[model samples]
Target: MDVIERAVSVLMHDGLVVYPTETVYGLGADAFSDEAIQKVYEAKKRPLSMPISIAVSDFEMLCAVAHVRPGMEAFIQAFLPGPVTVILPARNSVPEILTGGTGLIGIRIPSHDLALRLIERFDAPITATSANIHGLKDPQTPDECTVSRELLIDGGRLSGIPSTVVDLVERRIVRRGAEADKVEQFLSTL
Candidate 1:
């Protein structure tokens, strides 16, 4: 089977995966599975209080996990499928582990073809956190990924810049990284 098929199998079995995105490598897991979510936290040695983001394939998938508030769809369309993570109101189905009790979620729709394909094929949300130990550099290549995962889908060297985290509900940038300038420009026009 191809790597993506294998990755999907891994995910189906509650395994973790290291996959490439437009900006950096991401450690993917079944976002809705509490057990799988714990594995991701353990893999990165990340604190449970920190919370993790999630990746979706398209707008419909995104809305399934998050509340697309007023005028938020346009804001999401402006930067998503590129290198930005939009913070949104979480649906009840979203596990509390992902929200850190905040009732908010950071969602991504990666523009990278492989990442997109994997999510589409998996037909479910995957954890979108960087494929690295917490407090370490986000990996730009598979070789640079520091987290433990059952599978790794290499997409060669990435730009190394992480996705910019945005909170449209609050009208602010949470953590600026890739495409901050353009995001700011787009926000200005809003």
Candidate 2:
């Protein structure tokens, strides 16, 4: 089957699929589906306390899940479709499971076309956590990704660098990544 159709079908069925993102291979599932979201944490052996970041294709979808404030637009404009993740207050539409019962949600529009297309085609946001076991080295290639019999989309090798994470709620820097310095600079402007 085609990639888009396969991706949508898996998400609609609340199944997990590993796909390429700008930083690494990510395990994606329906962000709104509790069962699907739990599968991601289980599959990766990730802690329930550590929330996963959701990927959106556009501003409209981003706005749906997050309470977009005035300064948020400037941040999105500067780093969206890139490697920086913005933590925003969640709207009622976002599931508590996705946020790990936290009011804040991490969101991003990746620089990768395949990643963006999957979100656009699926017509829903997806939990885009790195496809790796917890505390394990993140997979840069599809084959390296340790998925358990799920649909894996190979988009060649990915950059080993993960996205720079910024917490807007705390108005401070979180863990730094590939474009850490650049992201910090951008955040300072706001």
Candidate 3:
């Protein structure tokens, strides 16, 4: 089977996978699977209180997991499928573990083709946390990943920066990364 198919299989079974994104490699798990989400935390040695973002295939998939507010569509059109993570109100279907009980969830529609294809085929959002121990450098390639996973979809040397995180609820840029200035400018127009 192809690498993506294997990764999808792992995700379907609530197992972890190490996959490349525009910015870095991510330790991915089914966002709705509590067992899989717990494994992601364990693998990364990440604190449970720190919520991880979820990666979606497209805007439709994003809407399925998040409550898309008015004016938010334009913001998403501006930065998503690129390197920006938007914090949105979570739908009832989202598990508390994925949101750190904050009632808000970060969503990413990555620019990388493999990442998008994987999520599309899986037909579900997957955890988008960096594939390394907490506080360590983000992994750009599969080899750099410190966390063990059932599958690794290596797309080779990802030289992009982390996605700028924008909180739509608060109407602020929570974390600046690749597209902070652009995202700020877009938000100003809203």
Predicted structure with the largest lDDT when compared to the true one: 1
lDDT of 3 by residue, 85-111 (tens): 999999999999989999999999999
**Against the hidden reference, what TM-scores do the models get?**
0.98, 0.96, 0.97
Report the lDDT tens digits of candidate 2 across residue range 1-190. Answer: 7987898898999999898888988899999998998899899888898889899998889999998787778877878889878889999888887787888899989889888988999998999788989888889987788856368888998997888888887767787887889887877777
| Residue 178 miss distance in model 2 (angstroms) | 2.2
lDDT of 1 by residue, 1-190 (tens): 9999999999999999999999999999999999999999999999999979999999999999999988898888777788999999999999999999999999999999999999999999999999999999989888889888999998999999999898878878889999998888888877
lDDT of candidates 1 onward, in order: 0.94, 0.86, 0.91
Off by over 4 Å in 3: none
Whichever of 1 and 2 has more TM-score, that candidate is: 1
Total backbone collisions for each predicted model: 0, 0, 0
Ranked candidates (TM-score, high to low): 1, 3, 2
- As for candidate 2, its clashing pairs are none
lDDT accuracy of residue 117 in candidate 1? 92
Q: RMSD for all candidates, in order, please.
A: 0.8, 1.1, 0.9
Error of 2 at 139 (Å): 0.9
lDDT of 2 at 122: 94
